[model samples]
Target: MARKTIITCAVTGNLTTRDQHPGLPATPEEIAQACLDAADAGAAIAHIHVRDPETAKPSMDIGLYERVVELIREKNTDLILNLTTGPGGRFVPSDEDPAVAGPGTTIMPPEKRVEHVARIRPEICTLDFNTMNSGAQVVINTPRNVKIMAEIIRDNGVKPELELFDTGDIVMANDFLAAGHVEGPAMCSLVTGVKYGLPCTPDAMAMASRMLLAGTEWTGFGIGRFAFPMLVQSWLLGGHVRIGMEDTVYLGKGQLTAGNGELTARAREFIERLGGEIATTGEARQMLGLAQ
Candidate 1:
């Protein structure tokens, strides 16, 4: 039998705005409902990022995260939660004083980055394993900082899903595994197509996949136009898949994606037609060694 493909829907991301897609969930209720809809439509895991309700900007506030998690659990969905520790890493240098951080910077200590993860104790949480320039600003997650964050996640019994933007990230993830910061049977996400990271191409995806630690359970994703293509490549490459408006706003060239559920249903079609069965929440937990 072909390996089960675990479809992970990234409900929202840090940088995307309402102008890009009004349907992008901003409030806790909307985000929770989006995760449920994705689960009902076929996603086994929901990768989440919360927003500041008033400004619609990404936030690290524990209150917002609590509300989203509470609502999702109260609804009693089967989706495995994968909260992000990716916020509090932005670093935009000031034009006047390059030595100082710009007004956009939100760099926080390791404690703040993993605060929500510790409080909510999700089944899985993202740990961005490398620091790279993202658009105009730099996302800083040094080895020291990452180690601290990983330790917190591990201690909480929450598996850390390593977010790899390039080969260097894979190297760091391996180091984390070997040093015993991250738990065994590593889980990683091949984050391709960032302007400063690996290009969104088959060769790039394959190369990054090849660099995964032995026995690593991994998935792959791309942004915007590259999203679906990466999903196809990810499944073809013997990994899993993730899709949603967080990664792309369009279902087709000109057509906008309706919601996370719609994108997830489309991903299920590709996996089933390719002879790969979609994994259930239970199966995904087993594959990733997530707790019962």
Candidate 2:
């Protein structure tokens, strides 16, 4: 029997991918509209990451986040909001010192990392478990930083979707669970195809899936070209799916994606053809233990 699958659309990520995909949402209105479209298409949840309007770079500004949330709520009240707390941790080393923060680094206090989560109190947010070589720069999220951010999210009644890129990240998540920082039936997301993290293979996905607790709920996403394949593989393994231009630029080999709604539609079609039903927002909220 096929289990229920939930489709999540990560509207716009923190990176600058507008040059690669012309339909990437860069402003608050565009981002909110993208979420509404994804929800209308079949996405139970919309994972959002706001970018600076001028530069289209990642931002942790509470105002920008608030505007996006408000816009989405005013338009579509049923779509689950999953904000990104994975920004503000980029640490690019300097060319001169080679040890200090480089030109691209956007490091900040851990509290500032989830400052928007505190103020907005979204239904869900992400917590990157491993900080490793992400291409040329290092993404730093120390244990102390995670503890502080986790405490804030928990206290504010927001759920942290712990992101695990590699197997080592599973250990970190287990530590948090053991420490009682996160609530029961832990929520997690396994990201693959990053430059230095785990590969997007069925074996790797299955290994990480087994590591999750019995009652734990998890989602899987792959970056760049690995997006669709991982979506199918994740559903095959009884996990939920997330996809958007945030993880890929192309709808096909050379075809640039039109929008996040396109990705969500394709994923929904694939899951339904496989005899699985797309979980609704209410079903997803119950499955993930989120208050509807």
Who wins the lDDT comparison?
A: 1
lDDT score of residue 26 within candidate 2 = 81
User: Alpha carbon lDDT of residue 2, candidate 1?
Assistant: 51
lDDT of 1 by residue, 196-268 (tens): 7989999999999998878999999899899998899999999999998789988899998889999999999
Candidate 1 stretches with Cα past 4 Å from truth are none
- Residue 3 accuracy (lDDT) in model 1: 85
Any residue pairs clashing in model 1, and if so which? none
Measured against the true structure, the TM-scores of the candidates, in listed sequence, are 0.98, 0.97
Output the worst ten-in-a-row residue range by lDDT, candidate 1.
Answer: 73-82
> What would the per-residue lDDT of candidate 2 be over residues 171-250, giving only the tens digit for each residue?
88988898898777898898888878889999999999998877888888898888999999998888999988788867
Over the full model, what C-alpha lDDT does candidate 2 score relative to the true structure? 0.88
